[model samples]
Target: EPVEVVVERALAAQAVGIDGVIASGQEAGPIRAATGAGFSIVCPGIRPGGPVGDDQKRTVGVAQAFADGADAIVVGRPIRLASDPQAAARAIQAEIAQALAAR
Candidate 1:
């Protein structure tokens, strides 16, 4: 769906008792327009800034995700496929902290 249309979906979901949306691509910008109204945004396919290895090209870095108004993020492939899963997890955690601090 077009980014703008996702906002409509978010609104519709809220109308039906849903509480959030999994924003991606440029949808975050539009989603933020609904900010004061209240709702959560969880961005998936979040990676550490590199060539997106999987089909979910709709990806964003940790900082950018937060900057774009993601309430939370789902880190998958990156940590699971990392040479050191523990370090990758920690790195992502640190990135999240930095992003939150910046906010």
Candidate 2:
């Protein structure tokens, strides 16, 4: 099936009580629009910078993901490679705080 069609189906499934929907950065907004407001959208492969070491073609950061209506954003390597993992997490938390404040 096409990606859009898959998103629609995923949204429909959530409407009928599926646990949640996994959306890519590009798919997050569209899936959210397709589903009801209450549907949970979980986005993975979120990298802040434009070209990380990984092979993920589509990616967005925590703030952007939240801004795009994602219920949650996942960040992997950025945190792992940080000299201070706690500080990295704190920065992400700060980003979330700013996003929440903006909203």
Candidate 3:
């Protein structure tokens, strides 16, 4: 869900009995919080540094977004734009592992 569509679609999904809602970038945590407990929020446009020439304006690092209560963070360009894509992904994974371990 984009910021413009979150409230309506989130409520719609909830009305339809969907298990969860995936809100992109900025809206994930707030949408999840707004939707109340037990609803999952999958956030896209997640990067360890920042946006990487991608269309996603709203972005945050893995640890920060995870700390903010996103159920999951989606990464695309961060790994795709890396010189060593696998290593970049592994690094991100390691960060996630650390974050999760701390929680």
The candidate maximizing lDDT is 1
Q: List the residue pairs that clash in candidate 1.
A: none
> How far in Å is the alpha carbon of 77 misplaced in model 3?
1.2
The Cα RMSD in angstroms, rounded to one decimal, for candidate 3 relative to the true structure is: 2.6
How much lDDT does candidate 1 score? 0.80
In model 1, the runs with Cα more than 4 Å from the true position are 35-37, 50-54
Encode model 2's per-residue lDDT on 1-103: one tens digit a residue: 3567768788678768896777776777777777757888888887764346567777776767777778887878778989998998888778878876776
> What digit string (tens of lDDT, one per residue) describes model 3 on residues 10-99?
878888898787666567666766687677778888988655555667787777667666778888888899999999999999988986
Best candidate per TM-score, number? 1
| Model 1 poorest 10 in a row by lDDT | 28-37
Tens digit of lDDT per residue, candidate 1, span 1-103?
Answer: 5776788888888779888888783577678776533788888888876336578777878888888788888898899999999999999999999989998
- Worst 10-residue lDDT window for candidate 2 reads 46-55
> What TM-score would candidate 3 get against the native?
0.78
Q: Give lDDT per model, in order.
A: 0.80, 0.75, 0.76
**Clashes per prediction?**
0, 0, 0
Ordered by TM-score, highest first, the candidates read: 1, 2, 3
The C-alpha stretches of model 3 lying farther than 4 A from their native spots are 1-5, 51-54
Indicate whether candidate 1 or candidate 2 has the larger lDDT: 1
Q: Number of clashing pairs, model 2?
A: 0
